[model samples]
Target: MVIKGGILLAIRYNSHRYTRDIDFSTNQMLGDINKDEIANRLNKSMAIMGESL
Candidate 1:
């Protein structure tokens, strides 16, 4: 996954901004969407980073 746009900059500087959007991308196609798996991965990653969604 890749992060871009204002959210990335905000995270880099730890500054408050009005942007309320997050954008991510992947190089390869995801054949099927897995809600549970995605949520688990996201939660785990956020925990590792001391953050939450």
Candidate 2:
């Protein structure tokens, strides 16, 4: 999923309950970041953790 900017994902720091889907929080990226690329990266990262898309 596409993560919008100016949000915070609180689960990273303290241990919090999480949902099945990942919640993202990112500051606005000034440069170019392809959506497909992000999806691919996320998919690869999830694969490493034995998670499926």
Highest lDDT: which candidate? 1
Q: Which one is best on TM-score? A: 1
- The TM-score of predicted model 2 comes to 0.49
Minimal lDDT window, size 10, model 2:
4-13
Candidate 2 regions with alpha-carbon error over 4 angstroms = 1-16, 29-32, 51-53
Cα error, residue 12 of model 2, in Å, equals: 7.5
Per-residue accuracy of model 2 over 1-53 as CA lDDT, tens digit each: 35432222433344354455555655657365587888899888768757531
* Candidate 1: worst-modelled 10 consecutive residues by lDDT: 14-23
lDDT of 1 by residue, 10-43 (tens): 8888767627877778765777666688779978
Error of 1 at 20 (Å): 3.0
Per-model TM-score versus the true fold: 0.56, 0.49
Error of 2 at 13 (Å): 10
